[model samples]
Target: MKKIAILLALSVALSAPAWAATKAVTLSISGMTCGVCPITVRTALQRVPGVEKVGIDEAKKQVTITYDYSKTNVQALTRATKDAGYPSSIKQGERDHG
Candidate 1:
């Protein structure tokens, strides 16, 4: 019975999806001239498939996003913001934080 339980646990661990690895990044956004710009940016980012959380700082024109690394990437995040009419790039000196 113990052996069976151990095997079950191992199997469960192995079956976990790669998306279990999450990462956070901060981005500097441009063209955010008014209140509605943040709303648009948030909507666009949320539409991404693996975005787990989004924190926007309108006063600083920056946003922090926590996302599933296996399902999405920095390029995708930047593209989303660009498509929403707010271009974005990784904040200087900010590295990926998991």
Candidate 2:
């Protein structure tokens, strides 16, 4: 009976799809020198289907976004930012110096 229960549990676990991973991405944004810039970025990013959260740092000219990889990607996020008129790109590993 124990062996059967363990097998059933293992089968159930293996049948379930693993949850997607979330990644933190920083984007360099241009034309965000004013207060509205952050708002614009936040609104745009939130519209994305998989974006979990967004944070914009005006002083650093960076926008941090948390998203599920399966639903969205960096390229799509960057394009969304650009479409909002902020014009953004991935910050790579570190914050932008500009």
Candidate 3:
């Protein structure tokens, strides 16, 4: 019975989703020239599949994004923003939220 319990626990652990790893990065957004720019940028970023959070500063032309690392990557994030009419580039430093 003890062996069976141990196996079950191990199986559960292995089956659990490994996509919890989160990455946070500040993106420099270009082409935001008006009051409605932030809204567009926010909407664009939120549309990404794994984006968990988005923080936008219109004055600074920056957007901070937190997303699941396994389901998405930096390229996809940038592409999404660009496709939304706000081109983005990853900043120099990155933060990892575990």
Candidate 4:
């Protein structure tokens, strides 16, 4: 009975959820020409699951997004922006940050 209980406890522990770390990435955006562009971009990024924060730089035409690594990725971030009418790519030389 003790052995069975130990095995059960071990199995439960192994099956527990693994929490993912937060990650951030910057993307170079295109087609943001007007004042409302940043708002649009922010909204798009925020709609993605796991997105925690979004910062937009209009003058630099870039956006930095923080998100949960398990729930999202750079591809999802770029896709969100593209769907919002402003396509984007990862900013050169900038890697995903935690």
Q: Please, what are the lDDT tens digits per residue for candidate 4 over residues 1-98?
A: 99999999998888754445899999999788899999999999999999999999999999999999888999999999999999999999989989
Worst 10-residue lDDT window, candidate 3 = 89-98
Whole-model lDDT values for every prediction: 0.92, 0.83, 0.83, 0.92
lDDT of 2 by residue, 1-98 (tens): 99999999998899754555777788988679988889988999999988888887889898888888778888889889889998887786764221
Clashes per candidate, residues 3 or more apart or on different chains: 0, 0, 0, 0
- Tens-place lDDT per residue, model 3, 10-75, is 988997666377888888887888999988888888888889999988888888888898888889
- Sorted by lDDT (best first), the order is 1, 4, 3, 2
Error of 2 at 15 (Å): 12
Off by over 4 Å in 2: 1-18, 92-98
TM-scores of the candidates are: 0.83, 0.74, 0.76, 0.79
Query: TM-score of predicted model 3?
Result: 0.76
Indicate the residue-level lDDT of 13 in model 2.
91
Among these predictions, the greatest TM-score belongs to 1
Looking at model 3, residue 42 earns an lDDT score of: 86
